[model samples]
Every structure is written in structure tokens, then in C-alpha cells.
Target: MASDHSLLAHLVPKLTRGVEDAVTDALAFILNESKPCRDALVDMVSVGDRRLASVANARTQVVASEGERLDLVAYDTAGSNRLIIESKFWAPLQDGQARRYVGHLADDGLAVLLFVAPEVRHETLWVKIARQFEHPSELKLGSTRQVGNMIVADVVNGDKRIALMGWDTLLAGLTNADSSMDANLQQLHCLALAQDEAAFAPLHAEDLNATVPRRLMAFNRLVDGVASRGAGEGWMTNKGLRAVPGRDGYLRFIGFCDTDGERLIELALYVSLKRWADLGTTPLWLRIWHKQAIDLVDLKHRLAEPGWLPAWSEPNWLWVPIELPLGVEYEDTLDSATAQVKRVRDIVVEMA
Candidate 1:
């Protein structure tokens, strides 16, 4: 038999390090050799006059500074101007990590902080982090306060600026420059896409396993209980309960719980919208257009009720909140989930 310590034990950790290294290497190559890639990155952060070639001057690395390590740091050849980037492939920014990064950069002087993550939603997480700074203010695009290209926020008495860039946006820019890129740079671009796919693949692959089925069973029990009471007589008519494939080919369920075209509700086993999208399914709110029939103010009030947990919503769907049990085996959680589903059903029925 193999010992407790084996080569495979370290494989995942090594792979994670390798992925980060590869990303950093690719970024450095782009900033050095490709002006187009550099310009795109500069545009993302809205660095007014600091072009990547002139300021960065091809000096980029995975930098260690003051007991914290940044994923990639591009500094000028003179070491005066620096662009610090924190890249994420699978993991997210840990608690207080963003705050520390912001504080550190603010004191460092004239630095632009960029955070690159797998999804755009991470941008929201970063924006919330910026709000926690000593002084946070939004840098508007024009007359209206809108976050364009990135959410640019000033921190620490306007000493440092923090910007969020999505991996997709970055990749799109890289893809556009593919025609002019050398063989090595092109290879790096492909590697970045492949890494993203690897990072996101689990969400689709794991859906048919024990966890999803367990959650679906719990959701079905809740739906059945409401139907038995005749509380869902007219609205909860679709009884076919199983995981249905979404646009991304991930197994998600609909028809298990729905409204009479007046409201939208769905229970997703996955944690975030990225995971749902990875599985090829449209979020419930995005699937339907029922805003004309539903009052947004009333919908918000209904969502505030006990047992109803808020999911994503859109202009057309108004509000779609769903009940997700803490654990399927727990009787209390099942009851809570059931009650939540019942409450939403009642609200829709009343609206109808």
C-alpha cells in the first residue's frame, strides 16, 4: 500500500501554483511584446496617461511585498510606477484580503490596483470591499454615475484607485490581438482559456451527483406539500419534477415550481450565478418576461417575508426568490424550505 505521503497528494497544490504562474507569464508577455494587450489593460483601469509599455516597460512578476504576495506586479523599469494585479482562477478574495491590498497600495503611492477574476460578479464583491475603505468614492464616467468598463473607486483619501476586471473581458481583448500575436503569446492566450474552462468544469460535472439530487428531492417535497393543501391549485400546475438542462448544458430544474406568468421562482442547487451559467441553464428570472403583470414594489415586500431567500432578478422578471434548505436530511430545514415555497406560491396565487 502507498504511504500517507505520496506524489499525488501534492499534485493539486502544484497545479494551482502552475496555473497562477502560467497566467502571470502570459500577462508579462502581453504587456512586454504586445502593445494591443497593454492598451486594453490600460483602458480597463482608465489609467489616463500611463501606457503599459512606457510605465510597465516589460517589468512584471509575481511580487512579494511587506509579508503579502501579489499574483502579478508590473512596474516601470525605474520602479516608480507599478500596476498590482490580483488574479483568481477558482478561489475568491478571502475575508479582509481586499481591504489589506487596498490599504497597502494606498500607502505605496501612485499605484493602480487591478483585480481579475473568473466572473463579473467578483467585480461586485470588490466594489463592496472598496466601500469599506477609509474613504470610498465612485469615479463616474460622465454626468451620470455609471460603472463603465470597470468599477473605479478611490480609496484612502484618493491616494490609490482600485479597479475590477473580469477574466472574460480580458480574454476578449487578448483574443482580438491574436492575429498579431507571436506563437508563444498565442499559446499563452489558449492556455488562459483552457485554464478558465478547467476551473469552471466542475460546476457542470458535479450537478448529477448526490448533492443536486438531494436538494431536488427536498424541493419536490416542498412543492408536493403545497399542492396537497390545494394552496397551489391553479398556479402550481406543472408537476414534472426533475433536473432539466439549461442553455449551458448543466442540469437545472423548472416546472417543479413556477408562477402563472405573473412571477418567477426557481431553486438552484448551485451557490452562484456563475455556477448556474456553467451548467448551461438560464436563471429563472432571466427565462421569463412578466414584469407588466407584477408590481416590483409588491414583489420586494413578498421577498422580505420569512422563509423566502432572494435569488437574482431582472427588469422583466421583477423578483424571483426561492427556498433552499440548509440540508435535505434535516426535518426542520425541510419544513422551512417547504414553508418558503408555500409562501411564494400563496403570493403568486393571490396575484393571479
Candidate 2:
């Protein structure tokens, strides 16, 4: 088994030793926190390691716990910049968990909920549950039983994504021999504080805001959850799904891996829409890429629309069909695997 130190040694050395230590400590603190402790902990790690060179003249502290007030709170300011962070945990966003959370955040305008759980299923899981409340019962998304420890559902800019780690995964990463503090794991560990619907982007900065309607929020929750759950259960490909919100909040587009072996190596496009192009909404393609497959369908539907046609949206998908050469082990072609992703991106651009 590879030790964390050995794994770190194998990577490129862009991170200064001090910065690396700070980054590692920040990740460690985040993993150990009961809920997301991003605002408080990020600064702590920065300060402890002198990584806050940029914020040398800032005032930072926790929010006052004035009775009936919510969870942990903190504030940071430097010269003209000021930021606030509020931390809290939510039961898995089910049975209207997201609606309640979104409503609360919208009322406040700026709040970050630090989720405490293992592997924040931010992209796929929570969003699926929220989508359930969006459409009528007839057009709603699906659900699954909550498993493992739940993390704080961080909501920033109306973008909702899971924080990924709680105590268990954090502890496991710290103690497990195979878990290394490498760039891949570290990048994966970087908390996607919110799922920006307007741009389908992930936000990590301290100060950012977005607007999300109740139904739209619910839709995002549903879309994210089902796709993530399906992928995890192996009904679909084990890769993360993609989501794209349409213009005017009229629709959302999504896509994922579809793993049905074909007579020849191939890639497929499955699509779903808000109402008109709602075909293929079920997890039937789970055999391919899990719920991510369905999310892809949603994306295709949007791309096929009049105003939101193919060129309107970027060629947002990049997938490659991979097959092991005869007698070639998977590890033997690690470089090739990476090349395959690059090829897929190239193919997508060509198609665009």
C-alpha cells in the first residue's frame, strides 16, 4: 500500500512546502469537522501556515451566538473586503429538506452550510431529491434511501452541491494506508461549495452569490441525487454526471456515461427535457452510466431546443469509448487512459 507521504512525493511540485502543508492541514481540518467548517478552518489553515500572505491585514472571528440564532458563524475582513460564513448540517435533502434550506438561505442572502458526512454527493444525489418537488407528481424525479453519514449541504449563490467529506471519510483518509495526500485526491477533496445553475460551474471562493427559485432548487436537487445514486449503485457508469441550466430558468440540461457494450466501440447521446422533451427520463440507461446517463438526456434535450440549440450551448460533453488491448493490463496504459479523455474532449470540440 502507498503511504500518503510517498504519494505526495510522486506528484509534481508546484505547491511550495509551506503551501502544501497548509493545504494538507486545511483538508484535514475540513474532514474532521462535524459539518463544513470551510470559512473558519480555511482561514485557520491559511494563517497557521502563513498561506494568508494576501490577507496580512484582516480581522476574522466567529459569529455571535445570540439566542435562537442558527449554527456556527464567522466573519473575515481585509481593508475593503468582508465575508461571512454560517455553518449548519441538514438531514439528507429529502422530503423537502432542500426547499427548507433554500428558503432560509434566500431570506438571508448569504450563508454557507458546512455539511458533515462522507463523500458529499453534491452534484448528483442532493439535487435529485430537490427536483422531486419541482414538477407535478407525474413529471417528478426519483429517490433512494440515505446511506452513510450525511454532510452539511452548503448553499452559496443558489448553487447547491454536496461537501463530500464528513468525519468518516476524513478519518479514513487520514488513517488508511492507500489514501494518499496526492493532487487527485486533494482536488477531489476540494469542497464544491455550491453548484452554480446559471453556468453549471463549481464555486470555491469565499464571496459569491446566486439566485435560485424554489422549484428550480428542487429540480437541481432531484437531478443531482438520482444521477449520483444511480451511478454509485452501478446501474450507470461510475463517472460524475453533468448538469446545465437553460436560459431564463426554463429548463436544465444534463448528461452522463452510458456503458452498454456495443457490437462496435461507440458513444451514445441520451436526452431528457423539462416537459416537451421528457422522453427517456427513467434510469433505463443506468446499465450504461447510472443516473448521470439521465442527466445527459436532460442536456441533450436542451441542446435540441429552438433557442437553446446545439451551437447555443457549448459542446459540453467529452466521452471516449475505452477498451483494453488483448493481454494488456489496465495499469499498463494509465497514460493512454488520460489520453482517451483528451481525445474525447477533442472529439466534442470537433462535433461542436
Candidate 3:
């Protein structure tokens, strides 16, 4: 558990008060200096208000506010258009912050509220945060409503219309801008790619084959057989074979097997960390057997055997050991593996 905290801490930087201010400064500079970038932004958020493009090149005033200050406030002098941008790099909106920010723009004529973040970095976490301030009807992504002649891409807090723009979208717009401005935007784009790459590095077959041990490889093949059987029986999705390498440099699997025949069962299914998080506080046992009405006493006793272990309570990972008969040819083990998986499945059905 402590390792998990350390891993997260190492991967994600501690967001300070000034981080948003720095982002605001960079974004404001690009919007004011680059006409193409500004026009793209206006086109994305102001769907019906095409006239906003006229002010894309207008002399703009950009201000960064702290505390009561809305992240970035840009005013176009020529068109008298105001863009109130709330930029969140890592942090979620504080309590009532969204409402207060929208309220600030309520009386400001010809103004739009834009919420910008790197959605890819945080997965759907930022999307869920944005939904909290949104009306139930505006829950879908890219949802829009017309406020008079102005178009609001994401409406929140009753009539407050806001646009949620991802960093990737902003980068695409910046890419089409004049090449002369590459020096300024290149650093930002590189940083964004680095963040994305760190999150999702591709796993190669050769890399796994070379690093993984033979025992683990055998265990993975057995689990793959179990998954295949489950999918064939219409109990699981046929996602094909997946060898998820954990942060600990070990291949994480759903089924476990012991090399010796000391244990009664040859193989049993387990749960992964990602699966645990997806299931929230629900126990893996409950999630797997919830539809069945199994006796708790029998279920507990069977799971308490040397070969069967319940999921961990703290980290919530399921790791049940299964015995594989020793001194058998590696090729001959498949029949046993298949039989074990069927036995586990049968136990579920019988206990139900």
C-alpha cells in the first residue's frame, strides 16, 4: 500500500498554487499572439457566435488572478469580447468554485467560460469532476446549448454555459499555426507528449519473452486457457490473451498455480489491482458470486483451504494458490490446467 503511494507520488508532481498561473500565462500568450490558435479556440467553443473570430486578432489583455481571480481572463479590445478560462492541470475544482466562476461571468456581456485540462492524463477523472457542476441533462460529452446567439459547449450550474477543452485539442490547433511560432509551442507540446507517453508505454512481445521467468510464463498460459474457457462459455469477453506487466516488473495474472502437487486444486482465479479499483469497495468474492446464493459458511471454508485464499482486505487483490502436479511433461500440463479451470467454474455453479 505504501508502495502504491510512493509510485503515484513519483509519477505525479505535487501541484502547487502557481502551476495553474504558469499554464495560464503560456496559454494566454499563445491566444493573444497567434491568430490561427485564437481562431481555432473561438471556433471550438463559440459554435453559433462565428462573429467572435473577428476579434481573434484584436489587441487582447490577459490577466492571471489568484484566490478570487479566475485563472485566465482575456479581453478582446476591438470586439469587446471576454473569455474567462479556468485552467486545471492536475487539481479538481474546489467546492462551489465552478458556480462562483460562472457567476462572475453572468453579468459580463459577450463573455464565455472555458474550462481547459489534460483529460488524457487523468483519464475520465476530470470529466467526472466537470459533470458535478453540470445539469443532469448536460452529462454527455460535447453537449451544447444556445445562450441567446452564443453557443455554450458544456452547460453547468443551471444556465451557465462552459466549454471543456482538452490539451490534445488545443495542441492540434496550435500545430496548424505559423511555423515561426514553433519555438514557443514546441516545448509545451513536447511536455504534453512526455506526460502521455509516461502514462501509456507500449509493451512488446520480445521484451516480455526475454524478461519473464518460465514458471510465470506457464502460469500465464494456464490463465489464458481459463479466460478462453470463460469466454467460450459466454461468461467473459473475448479480449484475447493479455499479459499485464505490473509496476513490480511481474506479469500480473487472474489465475494462480503452484508447481508442486501439495495443494488439492491445480489452479484458481485471482483479481488484479486495476480490477479492484474498478469494483470500488466491493469484495472480489462478492462480485464474482453475487448472482449466486452460496452458503457463506461453505464458501468461507472452501476459500480457507491451503490451495484457496480469499482476496486481500487492504490492497484488495485476490491471490488463490493452486497446485500443478509435479514431474509431468510441460505439454501434458494443459489437460490438467483445463480440468482445473472447469472444476473452479463447476464449483461456482454447484455452490449457487
Point out where model 2 deviates above 4 Å.
Answer: 1-92, 106-108, 112-123, 132-352
Candidate 2, residue 300: how far the Cα is off, in Å: 52
Looking at model 3, the pairs that clash are none
- The TM-score of candidate 3 is 0.43
lDDT tens readout by residue for model 1, 227-267: 44433444433345354544333333333234544324443
After TM-score superposition, the amount by which residue 60's alpha carbon in candidate 1 deviates from its true location, in angstroms, is 5.1
> Between which residue pairs do clashes occur in model 1?
246-280, 246-281, 247-280, 248-280, 249-280, 250-279
| Winning candidate number (TM-score) | 1
Model 1 lDDT vs. the true structure?
A: 0.51
TM-score each candidate: 0.45, 0.21, 0.43
Q: Higher TM-score: candidate 1 or 2?
A: 1
lDDT of 3 by residue, 2-79 (tens): 222333223334554353455466667777788777766666566653333233442213423344766666556543
Give the clash count for model 2: 51
